[model samples]
Target: MAAKKPWRIIPRPLLETILNNHAQHHRVPQPLLLHGPRGVGKTTLILQRLLPDWNKGPHLTGYVDFAELMKGNLGTSPGPWASWSTCPQPRLSDCRKILEHCVESMVEKGVSAGTITSQQIFTTLNKWHGLTAALRHVLQSKSRASDRASPAALWERAVFAMSRECTTAEVGRILGFGENEKNGLSFEEASYMKESVAALKLAKKIIALQQGWRANAITHMNRTGLFSRTLTHSCTDWPCLLLEFLSQAAEIDHFQPKLVINNIEVLKHATVNSESTVSGPLYHDSLIWRIIALGANERCLPVILVTSDSYYSYEAFLEFGYMEIFISREVSVEGLLG
Candidate 1:
């Protein structure tokens, strides 16, 4: 038998094309769905090679496992529109905390894989601590006797205030800025705790928006007329937050943001459609398409949709011709990342 490779394998040309486009176009076409037979390794490449390196640049990087997201929703079990609930909205501080944890977790993996050093980890942790201190100081200095805001809300205000004080990228970079540009550190070696911290701070504002939308959706659930349309519009716009975050980072880093959506097939399962088609419950997919179209039009971020099965839909993503599909014959995480 031929010597078996260690990682999952993706088409070399497709990978090169993606990297090249990101370097030149400053944006990846949205819904660049990867279609292939089941067990072809599309999802493997996306999760390992693409998402990890994506926004870990000078600004922010985020990943949402669609399959996981879908599994969380009770509606996914009965087919589209069986039932739905607004996904839990996380606060900005909470977001940062999650990011920080992810990065720390990533670093541990990197070290085990011989990708980073102990000193690097400490430096990154210190940066996060410094930001936390700064945010606390800012919040205390601004508090007034009449102020009655909760601690979390006050922290959110302070984060925005901090955002306005420095260039957004600078703030973002502080949260997860790597020395790839000036210090010559590999992305893994760079400090990202700050970026995670910042994400936590930003989560507060995002939660408020989600809360309002959730309320509206619940209110109009009975009346499917104009309410359905309104509901779809609100939900569709949510992904734009990610787009905007990437775009702003591109400006700061002078590199287009590259994004990867892992486990695309799971989305079909995750999307909720209303049982009452006339009232047309919001489609889980509509939001995804909107995200792709907007990303392609803006051309600020390059997006890759990763899937494991060949069942692909053209109706949703035909406008962007830049998509490339890969089929995997062997299963190995090393090959995929390589």
Candidate 2:
């Protein structure tokens, strides 16, 4: 065997500052924007130091490298939906991919720490994905059986099946069911389950609409009467749907989830000049804004964005109105050398 490489992580003062603040405040730290030049070890410090430290606690953590996401290596699918010609660039599909990555990371950490069983996470995620897939199948199907029922009726049944499939037992287990002497879930747990189901139902609708858009069948969709004119309106607003899905997932285990994304500068390049009419920073108009809002909201998960671009300046963040959420910080190679 070749010589094994030892893990060597240089400690950074900035990481300590953020951790100390979080420890003292007993809340998620403000979103951090770690910017530096290439080879400054920003990614290394996050992956090797901060992430490991955060994972050691009750807090759940998610790590996404945009570089990896761009290369079609992250999330459940091999590549992003943008790879499909009909799909709008950096649309809801990208948001879904990011959320999937975070949820996967949360599950992995929860399982490894023994706070949650692998079976539970696997079962839950499978059921969730299955429901969405089933809805997609129904919308996309051309078989006579599917044609027998109106798409609206088929969609309602699919949502019902999904709700029924996500039983109290499943939600209970995820919420640490046996921790108390309760026979079943409490009102709050039930409420969360209901919310999760609603979000999933909406996701199915959104996915179906996305597929329709991809197929260039929006004209046909307008005639489907599945959701009336609202379908067209809602389909274009992917960020809201994505936030609902991710927020519920973050709240499931009552774990304070942290989303750490590296190489986020890749987004700047991806959104350089799109046909999207949404205003603000190129990222602010896309899925990134929703992510930032998620972090900013105390009720939702926190986010940490990492970049290696020196040009990602304070003025840009201020202009985007993200300065309040993302405090600028830099990790220098020379500082690490000392």
Candidate 3:
């Protein structure tokens, strides 16, 4: 990976601490929404700077093009319920197909087709090696797969696909080609087909772990941009799900704090749509918030949030709960980079 350009300015003290804590612990908190005007970089802060800090270890971090995913499902885009329905249930197999085709195309296009007798090519070699290598490594190692498949083995055939620079689009193309390939296909076709199968199997395994079926009622199925009303109905059981997950985590891993969820407006919308109030302030409504309040009351989990601008309603929430230390300042780049 290359060094990224520095951010325009330093991060606020409050943002720094929250991100640090999230990085230190593995759990993402749901109350930390930084709400304000558009230019403040609320989404950029969480999606780019904050979430990367939060996901320090083997945790997977990537954004799905929710707009595209929604459009494909609903035959349109920018609908109120786009994120709710389409975002949750991702077609893992289909995703793999698209990714595989992309890689294949990059490999083939990088060099002249059958130009070199020493390195003659037959098909499109989409340059998606880096991404494919990373993903394959994760699937085989970080997740503890029973079978260990090598990257070299996955890319043995270079007829249509070559081994070269891999971009996001290349990944998509590789999967597409694999799905569209015919039987007795070339190396590229076979590799992509294999990828599709593997992705499906992995998706099934993850879904099974979440619940008995492919769709989980809570966390796995919840989308970030859901309409307040639709989201509330869909995630009505989130409180119980979150509680259950936390309890399970507590039982299995006595490790440090884990995962912090930033940008909690999504949760707020979900709660409001469900016709539930978060209680005492912040206008938060949900079983999870209630649980957090109980914990805060007992001095268990300390809840916090970052804001682009101050909202008196949030101050009221803390006051009603008799909770002190609910606020903090932002941090500088020196503090974060170090």
Candidate 4:
């Protein structure tokens, strides 16, 4: 076969216009969907041109290719839940990795911008890694004598510990508890702290689950009810956890993090064997839906999804009642070749 032509990236003016409008809006902008034919350089233009610009400015950018994520899930065994095993894709772990990577990228940008010190970044990342390992050990331990607590309880305790290190008084101060204060926190401060703590909790949870301990829960599923709850709960909140993390991290007054999800078609196209009896859309209640919700809500950061499949059109998303979630834009490489 002849050598494939060098890929050329076309400037997507319409998509860029949508992104700019969202960035300048007083409220959170709608998520954007870039759909076109295969080999159109949709992924290239964003990764090469757009993301770098965002990173250099006030915004942070994160990119994840769902196709690669699917490939990574192949060698891994599904956890004890037969339902989970029947699903062709392992999404929980994928979400965990994506969140972790995004946070790490954000911190690195903060360090470079002098908003956060390098030492602080290293300390936080190291602590997160250590906590992840410890949580994994606790979950995978076969000996009941080691710890009989449910994984969710253990995770909650871990999150509480990671939130902040302080005495009772310090905790009160962080929460705006003052000696002379009569009433609770002001609305603004209360909202900020609530959001901050929630984000920290979610970050810790994502890291812990990234260890793939849920697979171990399957072995003990029949013996303990907690395992089932833990598995189901974690699986359901992957997207919410990510949105929380992004929202909290981008709490800066002026800047919003830009999230780019590449090859989102994978989520739309994934299917199990026809004989498997799996009902419902492949990703109906999964992270994809949460992403749509985040896109529709004005509270979260901006998200951009790039796909080659025509099936993921605006009308299709509308059928799912996500009409306000994504602004569809088509890009073509043919425009650049000339």
The local distance difference test score of each candidate is 0.41, 0.46, 0.33, 0.49
Can you give the lDDT of residue 132 in candidate 4? 41
Worst 10-residue lDDT window for candidate 1 reads 325-334
Q: Write the per-residue lDDT of candidate 4 for residues 208-301, one digit (tens) a residue.
A: 5652555455435534533243344344443455454455446454456667777765554445332211212433335556666655553556
* Ranked candidates, highest lDDT first: 4, 2, 1, 3
| Alpha-carbon lDDT of model 2 | 0.46
Model 4 TM-score? 0.51
What does candidate 4 score in Cα RMSD to the true structure?
13.4
TM-score of each: 0.46, 0.50, 0.33, 0.51
Model 1 residue 201 lDDT score? 39
The sequence of per-residue lDDT tens digits that candidate 2 reaches over residues 213-321 is: 4443334443453333233333334434433333444533344556666766555544322222221133333445545554566334555666644434434455457
Count of steric clashes across candidates, in order: 29, 0, 59, 1
Angstrom error of the Cα, residue 247, model 3: value is 5.5
Residue-level lDDT tens digits of model 1 in 1-338: 12232234566566645544443345444435543434444455555654555545532334544445434545435533223234432222222233334333333233323223323322332332223433344566554422555444555566445444445355335434443445444564333433333433344244334535365554556464454544444443324443543443354344444445555544444422332221221434454555655555654455445554333433332432433221121221123322
Ranking the candidates on TM-score from highest down gives 4, 2, 1, 3
User: What is the C-alpha lDDT profile of model 3 across 251-319, one tens digit per residue?
Assistant: 112222232233333333322222222211132344335545535432222223433323322343454
